[model samples]
Target: MKSNFITKITLCGLLLNGIYSHAQQTTLEVNTSKTITKIQPTMYGIFFEDINFAADGGLYAEMVKNRSFEFAMPFMGWSQPNSNTHSLNANSGIATPVRTSQNSNNPDFCRILINDDKGYHIINEGFRGMGIKKDAKYNLSLKAANHNNAIKKIILQLIDKDKKVLGETVITPSSTDWKDYSSQIIATATEAKAQLKITFEGTGTIDLDMISLFPEETWNNRKNGLRKDIVQLLYDLKPGFLRFPGGCIVEGRTLENRYQWKKTVGAVENRETMINRWNLEFKNRQVPDYFQSFGLGFFEYFQLSEDVGAEPLPILSCGMACQYNSGELVPINELDPYVQDALDLIEFANGAETTEWGKLRANMGHPKPFNLKYIGVGNEQWGPEYIERYKVFAAAIKSKYPNMIIVSGSGPSPDGAFFDYGMQELKKLNADIVDEHYYKNPEWFKENATRYDNYDRKGPKIFAGEYAAHPKGVEDGLKENNWLSALSESAFMTGLERNADVVHLTSYAPLMAHVDAFQWAPDMIWFDNLNSFGTANYYVQKLFSNNKGTDVLAITKDGKPLTGQNELYATAAKDVVKKELILKLVNTSGKAQDVTINLSENNVNAKGKLIILTNQNLEEYNTIAEPTKIIPTERDYKMSGKKSVLNLPAYSFTILKLKMK
Candidate 1:
């Protein structure tokens, strides 16, 4: 009876899968002559925010947690073994966290008192434990002050879960004052979850701060730099623009804590550390170790944008804190400083060497300006107060630089009274561009595919600045990042491309999240100590961004747009320089889709490339172990004259590029 029941259950599962796999065939007519508009070069881009340990523990590539001891809980990431807390028969000393200096952004440091000759160790549990590669070199650096010149030697070793040494180094501090020390270690064994153990040789007291370790080979081989693999994923996207340092972080929980671009620039040591506004946002997925080291600061952002050939779009705080939390504001009389910061940022990015801010930029490494063209005044702000402050910023920026394009905010959600009011006011003010944010479910994304079809063409341009599809049900816990949400978002992106005339720029929000230390869900990219992988949504974004055509072409079924009809969505574009016609099709139905694509008024080559990204199950997702499970698979296609018959897989995003002859 049990065997029969199991067989029946398996049969039922197969039948249900087959039912969802039924395909709905349709004809997609692409009229090359019916060009809707010119697709903006900055159409598809990336939105970066530091939430979920995206910076300190994730991308920044710093192996030491609380490097500067600047987190609200200074001793949060450090542990002293063989001490009084963990052992009763303790012969080791204690490491005391203290704030010794004032007037600096980072003032806290750990002072270890070696009570005996026995090895007293201070261990640093890296962000989810350090990812160590066998035979790979790691650079170690720290600021130390030999209090009373009592300490003789400090030993550093990288140990695995079993306390087996992977790498080791020794540092001899020869200074009584706070001084920097550096060393290198090559790992003898690979370990994904390694801890850094620092032990004092002789009984004495030593002060330490800014304890940092990084893989010797980073992206661009820069010291104290970003993770190569993660940045490589972003660079592969070929994004049109890279919006930096942001989302809610642009607006802090308090006005005093807002992201100040000037502070993020300049020398790395002088750059003050601050508490990330996203810290402690989720009680369940709490990330208390999350903080911005700013080592990958403004200069790095502009450099990354330039490296990837993406336009830099820097968003700034407009004197108002996060509305959802504190809603703190700077009185109108005190708004000049905020406005000045905006002006200074422009100078820092584009000013000449003779200018004040430009000199600082040149000193940081790049002598020539970043060639910044666009500036965003706020992120996810709302109401009359925002409009009033925006006017002041607009006036100041325009007076100094009329050609500079300034973007204003339209609140958090895509709809609501505040969003409408903000949009209406910005329209009245003749703003250059209006930024909109959206965080909705998959169905909302599918239904809103034609969101910009009715937008005012005469008003300021639209920037779909922050958007992502949340697929999980209404639960208080974090949502799953799966293929269903990604495919749904791909369907919605068709509308964004179709209305390229009004939608000047668009990017997915919360670009990356660390699996072990994250507060937000449904992120585009996920990573851990040693490895990283892009979600299905990331590949969808890459397909759109990498192939974003130069001009928009209309692809319609019958006489109307193809959106959700027969669970299919489509958009077409032409690359003038490449002399190719690009067609993107999303099949949301269960079965495969047999569609005939008619390229009207256009001639194309016989051979082309067809790329398909799909997953058998909607709930299936890409993981660190199976990073390429949902990646695109490319194949050769033979175009049948002006008409091509292509079969799109069920629940897939397909892109076809055919040469125009």
Candidate 2:
């Protein structure tokens, strides 16, 4: 029955993608005897802010982006603005539908209403005065009313049955264009039904547009904001940190083009600017065109870390420009202001009351410093420009925030002298860490696991910023692996574990890419708005990251090759706080293997609890058409201990946590 069921499920499209039944694999004797796996706490991360899920704008934004928010724009008598993430601007070519005349009633957030259909409104904003209801304010224009003159101001008021003020509006004189006059309303009392009255108080007809409202509480953190549903999935992985914004988004066309810190402040629509990074056109769903007004900004990144019990490792832009797809490296002299931006950025993150940018931090509601510990200078710099700019930024920041750890991002080539040269440069600049990325073949991974053995721990530490094993891809030049990739990844992790103190932190980057909406391939977590599922690489990360311990424990296990193919990659550590021994084991063999575990030296031995992720076939994948096909499962292992042998299924990953009394 089970075989028939799998046959039916696998038949549906398994043959379509060129996947065969699980690949025939072989295993060889692997060892825990001589290998000393270091146990270092890793700051495992996903590109949560904008890389994986676009959950900004609450249900509306994520829905619209996902093409799920299906409201007819010109819904008969009902009307609403374009409501795209970006503001409706001519230069931006962004548009929305709205009602603004006597026959047209604006439902606050629905649209801006102009007196009986005769003008326009533009959203004008700054930091302090933009609040949803409490601090929100707006304007109206009648410029299109033929003989109507430009109004100096407009007194907007909302009244209930007894005539109590429920909302208020005001206009400004800066009218080169039809500008927006807006403010949040703090009704003396609550009233569901209210009437809006625009007291022109000036020589002109009145016009109004869309007005948006949000409780002050909901708008607090915008960028790194994860929907509860998405957060729940992420929380399950138990990651230690998050990499915000994105690798390419950090370096914009111009300084102003760069993410503006000031635009993402406060508790209202006015204070935020929406600049999202993903554009889903399949369903007319567009995101990244608008920044959620960045309602959730940098300050929120810190808060999110606290919320998820993770640490914050913020990176600064190096002066060197980024070629999103061109893959060209800019020369050094061309990158200057960008370097300074890096310096001042740190001032904003960790400076005190005495500094200018720090005062902005204080004004943003976090008076005390964010205490940002890890500050990466540049991201994936491929040219000499990145190297030089990194030095300048490193000097300035280290001079100011001496205690901060400066991380360096090296390009993909291991043979590239840049890493060696970059490492040598760090010694002079007193760099705290070096970022090494790996996007390679399973065999290369097997060869590269010990790549850091020659690395000097006495020197700056290291971080595996972006890495994955794929079937021969362009970026990593990784060759293909049939069933052995999972085990190869597990093998690489063994080295990371054995060298934890020196490894300091590690994260698998470009963590996710929506399959059809992908800019990059073979992401750690892949999904669309409707559904999401992690990849095999993600499982490897989850297995290793979730079972981390505060200190390394000496462990020993002996086993022969479970199969003729490369097999059995494993790591072990003792959890200091829980008094438990956790072992991460992976079997690349296509068949089950019996393994003997000896834990007599660690003292109190108890039955082991296992959380496993196994697929009947190795080629199983998640797609937009069917998203839940391949997900990890958790099961309890029946036995353990010295001379005790147990069976491990093939092409699978297992994380075993054994408790000690």
Best by lDDT: 1
Candidate 1: misplaced stretches above 4 Å?
1-23, 85-91, 474-479
Which run of 10 residues does model 2 get worst, by summed lDDT? 1-10
Q: What is the TM-score (0 to 1) of candidate 2?
A: 0.66
Looking at model 1, the pairs that clash are 20-590, 21-590, 21-591, 22-591
Predicted candidate 1: what Cα RMSD to the true structure? 5.9
Which candidate number would show the highest TM-score if scored against the true structure? 1
Candidate 2 ranges beyond 4 A from true positions: 1-38, 48-226, 253-256, 260-293, 323-340, 352-355, 427-430, 472-488, 513-516, 526-533, 554-566, 600-602, 623-629, 637-641
Task: Summarize candidate 2's per-residue lDDT along 457-549 as a digit string, tens digits.
Answer: 678777777776665433321112222455567767766776676787777656565433343455665544334555556666776777786
Q: Give me the displacement of residue 534 in model 2, in angstroms.
A: 3.8
Candidate 2 Cα lDDT to native: 0.51
